[model samples]
Target: MRYRDENKVLAIREAAIDMVASDGLENFGINRLAKAAGVSPATIYIYYKDKEDLLTSISIEEGVKMTRATLKGFDPNMSFKEGLWVQWQNRAAFSLDNHKSAEFFEQLRNSTYKDKMLETINDEFRKNMGNFVENAIERGEIERMPLEVYWSVAFAPLYSLIRFHNEGKSLGGRKFKFSEKIMKETFDCVLKGLTK
Candidate 1:
């Protein structure tokens, strides 16, 4: 039995993410991915069974990575403001540093694979996030609201800013650059709206 090459695997993964992000999933295929990764289609088969398997596997791996990055140093028991600040810092750092992976996930979330991907997300991530929201509501640190509303208010602005940063321009063709100051100011507004 031949052993799989880690370098090739990494190359395939990166190429797959870039392809999917740039060309959309409809245009992704093993042949195209093999060419992009400089590997043969047989090599991809060594690791993944088929297109669905490959896409799902990569999405699961990326989701775990994102979960870990988002949850670093976070605790459900912390005050809502403190916990959310940590989340903001971690998420902003991860999304900025891994913009392609972030974009891939954004696309995945809207695709037919979304349900399957969500089913595979880390259990700890779900638990901690759920507990954090519950604790916040119980402690009166944040208003009781639907999950959709909470996510929209808590994270939509951060994502919008990240999108602007990635594009290098914002509204009115203004040059855009990401800064901690901007993130903090945006977080403050989100925090105030979330809390009483």
Candidate 2:
């Protein structure tokens, strides 16, 4: 085999993300991935154990980035609303600027491998998020509920808007855009409903 090249691994990852996003997960295969990456199937084996391993790698790498981006400016001492606003902004910007990573994430989150990917996410990032949520509940800033519910309430809308904006789609003939006004309104509405 030729000397190992890190660029080949990165190309494989990029191709995997694009392929997974464009085609359903079930349709993805080593031959197609190799062709897309311009690398041989044997080379992929050198870098990854199998398709599952490569997919898991993508999940962990992108998951950490998205998690770190989501937690940018997160402060347990700050009001829950302030933290949420910061989260919204970070996530929106990350998704808009890194569409491939964002799409890879969205696809993975909705795939059968989601549970396994979640299990492998960075523990430090998970703990920080948990601490923020627990602190909010203890402070009586939000009602007691599963962390997933709280997150869905806080971010699902923002994700929808970002998706529309990325696709340049219009809602009733008006192009979708993310703005401070939209962010503030979303934060207010979602936070108010969660508050005690």
Candidate 3:
């Protein structure tokens, strides 16, 4: 509440993310988030006209941030296998390192998402993903599967890994930290099956 103006807005967003990650979006009433953010509910009203407006803003902001983070360290010109490997590693590490963002995405995966918010969120990631795959296929570096089919195969494995870790699954009695080894293995298996 006492932070600088920009910082307060960020705190509101962060608090909203935490609330949704912890309690699910259905529980994200403005009063609840404002209290969690240590601001008056009216303060939230000042920044957002309503709860849906707040959610739309959060979804767009977080979605773009996640998309940017996912693309970090990915080489657009690498060999198909190498690009896939790096992408997997980057994507998993981004999700695991930023659990709230990961959880926020997981929540968005369900169809219960409000239509307008979901459209904005999906558009952010889907465009990058579509372009990446389309470019690879156009160059004959990757398989010719339909875009949606390719997306499903590419994202499914990583989704499982993230979900398992989020659910507190461990390996060999140790917690399953997202690692290069896991990313490499996942990428190898997926790309091998998808490539000519």
TM-score of each: 0.96, 0.84, 0.81
lDDT of 2 by residue, 92-178 (tens): 888888888777767788888898678766787778777878888889888888767877887887887777777777577577777
Q: Residue by residue across 18-75, what tens digits does model 1's lDDT show? A: 9988888888899999999999999999999999999999998988888889999999
lDDT score, residue 52, model 3?
72
Which parts of model 3 are misplaced by more than 4 Å?
1-4, 111-114, 121-128, 170-175
The model with the greatest lDDT is 1
Name the lDDT value of residue 145 in candidate 2.
88
Candidates sorted on lDDT, descending:
1, 2, 3
Best model number under TM-score = 1
| Model 2 lDDT, residue 169, Cα | 73
| Model 1 lDDT at residue 172 | 93
Alpha carbon deviation, residue 102, candidate 3 (Å):
2.4
Separately for all candidates shown, the number of backbone clashes (residues 3 or more apart, or on different chains) is 0, 0, 0
Clashing pairs in 2: none
